[model samples]
Target chain A: MRVFAALVRQGMKVMLAYQWENYMGLVGNFAFLLLFSALWSALLRGDPEAQARMLSYVFIGQLLQNWTFTPTWELAGRFRMGDVALELAKPLSLPVRVLGDFLGRNIVRVLRALPAFAAVGFLMGIRLPDWPQFGFFLLSAGLAWVINASLYVGITLISLWTTYFDQAHQILDFLEGVFSGFYVPLWYMPPALAAIATYTPFPGMFFTPAAIFSGGLQGAEALSALAVQALWAGGSLLILYGIWLGGVRKMTVMGG
Target chain B: MLHALRCYLLLVGAQARAQMQYRFNFFAQVFSMIATYMGQFIALSWLTDRFGSISGWKLEEVILFYALAILAWGFAVSLFFHLVSFEDQIREGLFDRALVRPLNPFVQLLAGQSPIAGTGQLVFSIAAFLWATGRAGVVWTPLKLLYLLGVAVGSALILGAALVTVSALGFFTRRTYTFYWSLVFPARQLVHYPLNIYSQVVQWLLTVGLPFAFINYYPAHVLLDRAADLPWPLLAYLTPLVGVVAFAAAYGLWCLGLRSYVGAGS
Candidate 1:
């Protein structure tokens, strides 16, 4: 717990250092939200239900989505600099530290996005979620973040095989953004595609949480969504752990 | 100018050769880029698939706009990708060295290479443009063909200039990624859909304030033979003019930034 707390603190410090960048990024985020919201307003046309509900979905979606933005680690650069060998020799567990660091970093990023959320809420006129809906949103969001962060960390562990791991991050972030419904509401997605995404971890990554907030999923349906998120969160971490072990063994073989 | 062009070619040749050394990583990056746009296009296809049209503009028309913007942006970024790290380049003294080099700094910097990821994006944009054109069933007359060519050239120039101006900010702000995206992306994205779909105020912002409308929307309007809501119907034909003026303005700004660099010595 202390180590996690320290990692969180470290993440907050780095985030604070680039406070101006965060502000600028949020401004960009709002501009995009406004553009999309207006377009959605037109697309929804006379459908009051979709107009009202999807606005919340789009508004809150990116904020929850960024909680797991990847490329949080520079493991390959560390390896090149001999830092990774030292890190591996350390008494601490690298995965746990990496997870803690990532959790801390994302917490700072999400907190910084609060102002954008408020602006989107006000301008787009998002319905205020009830207390129970808000609770599920938070829980689902936490699970989603775990899944996303672990996937990214696992991808970075490819440093165990190659000299670098990059250019891949852009594609990953793009695919994740689309699949998780940050760019568009999953409800509007082709039914078959949306169903497939539900079984994968991608829906839990953003759609489930935002859908709950928008009241698109409720009662038994909402509980099922939460279960999916929980299963994905644990399942992805265990799989990532297995991948990391394989990567570490390969690194040892190469004496890297 | 010809000499500069030759020098640029030589620099880019060296860059391409070095990039080719990592053939596998290069191909992997290109594949990643293809996936990136495939994902985006899928999202777009899903939206248009769900709703027949967004704000009365059909999916084919929207795809045309989207493809044009992607092509222009792909060209601009490929031309000025090192500028993506304007601050880092300045801090690392690469910008200073560019200044010292006999060759024009912008040309050299423009010649500086990006990863192979960009090639796939440009290819994808071209494919999308062709597909949209075929699906839309627009009559491609000779004059319209010429007009489309002009539009392509004009958009590339304007976007490339925008990138240069954004990069020049490293001289003053010393941090640009945030500010650059705020200015660049919103306007760039606005073009992906018809400007008419947005509110009048948003349209005014794009047209008068930022002038991004001239990049893709106006040319698209001309190509599609759609009349503008704005008073002057001739404005749609002026995209090339807008492009030339924007490039001139941005080029002048770069000179000013260069002067500042000498005075400030950062």
Candidate 2:
């Protein structure tokens, strides 16, 4: 716990040092939000009620996205630079440490994201979840983070087999966005694609929390969704554990 | 002009050679880029499925706009994408080094890096263009073919002008990544859809303010013969002209910005 806390603090320090990059990321979030909002408004034909519903859906989805953003390239980069030796030398578990760093960066992200989210939400007149729904959202969001981090750790561990995983990572990143409802809501997705998404772990990563926050799912439906998210979170972590162990064993550190 | 083209080829060729050494990396890059852009197109197609068209532009028609926009921007980016990192060039005093050289600093900055990353977008755009042409029901005449060639050149210049303009602004404010995101990129996004779907203000901005519409929308409009419906249908034929004027103005801004640059002195 102490080591994890220290690692978290270290991550925060590193992120804060490059605070301008974070600000730029927020700007990118705003750009995509604007594009999507314009797109949805055009599609919905300026129907205020429908538009407001979509605004909240997109806003909460984007806010949660920025808040829980992970460095998908971190492990790939470290492996490429042959720093895995140093990384493994530490007594603590690597995935745990990575999770700690993710948490640390997210704390700053959430802080930076909230005021912007609030201001935009207000101006856009977006719907907000009620107190009970907000509680469910926070819980579901935590599970989403676990699922996302686990998937990232697993995906980036492909660096063990190959020196460069940039292309692979990029493909997976796009797929993650598509499947997780970061690009389009699951409700709007074609039946075939949505069916495939149900079997993938990605829906737990973004859609569940966003759906909960936007009040798209409630009561029994929301509870069932949470259960599904928990299943995915646990399943991915278990799979990630095996991959991490095998990948680390296969990893050969070459000297400079 | 001949000397400048030779220097541009030499520098860009060197970077291309380096990138080719990693054969797996290059193929994977192109493959994934195709997949990413294809995914976006598929998403759009899915939306069209649900909504039955965006603003009365059918899927095939929108594909014309998308392919043209991407192709123009792809050509421009394949040449000037490195300018996206112009902030780093200035901050690291690389601009100072370029200034000391006898060659044009604009060409130097442009040719200083690899463009292999854009090959995927170019590949996808061309493929999409070929596919869209048949379904779009446009009778390709000899004149229309010539105009299409002209559109590629003109639209690329317009997109390049936008890139150079934003990069030139970096000389004034070194931390201008946010500026690119806030202004240039979103504008790029807007061109993918039919301009009519957007508000009149957005249409005017794309047509006149920044003139990004020349990169795709106006040319597509003219080719599709939707000109009769528009107030200034003639603007559809003015893309190549718009490109020359916009790029010249952007170049003027770049020169002005260059005069203001003091080295980072790091």
Pairs that collide in candidate 2 are: none
Q: For residues B52-156, what per-residue lDDT tens digits would candidate 1 score against the true structure?
A: 888777888888778877877666656665666677677667677787789998887788884343687788888988888788777789999898778777777
Against the unseen true structure, what C-alpha lDDT does each candidate score? Answer: 0.76, 0.82
lDDT (10s digit) by residue, model 2, range B1-266: 78988998999899899989988888888888888788778777778778878888888888888899889877887887777778988888877888888899988888876777689989999999888877888788999999998999999889888888888889898866656765778788878888887768768878889898888888887778787877888888898999899899989999999999988873
Instruction: Encode model 2's per-residue lDDT on A1-256: one tens digit a residue.
Output: 8888988888787777877777777777876677677778888875776676677778887788766788867667777778888888888878888888888888788787788888998898876789999999999999998888887777788787775567777787778867888767788898888978966888888888988888788999899889989999999898778878998788777962
Worst 10 residues of 1 chain A by lDDT: A247-256
lDDT of 1 at A87: 77
Candidate 2: where is the Cα deviation over 4 Å? A17-19, A46-50, A74-79, B90-97, B114-116, B176-183, B260-265
User: How do the residues A150-242 of candidate 1 rate in per-residue lDDT, one tens digit apiece?
Assistant: 877877777777754666566667768687877776778888877888888878888888899889988789899999889989988987788
Q: What DockQ does model 1 achieve?
A: 0.65
For candidate 1, the docking band is medium
Clashes of 2: 0
Worst-scoring 10-residue span by lDDT in model 1 chain B: B257-266
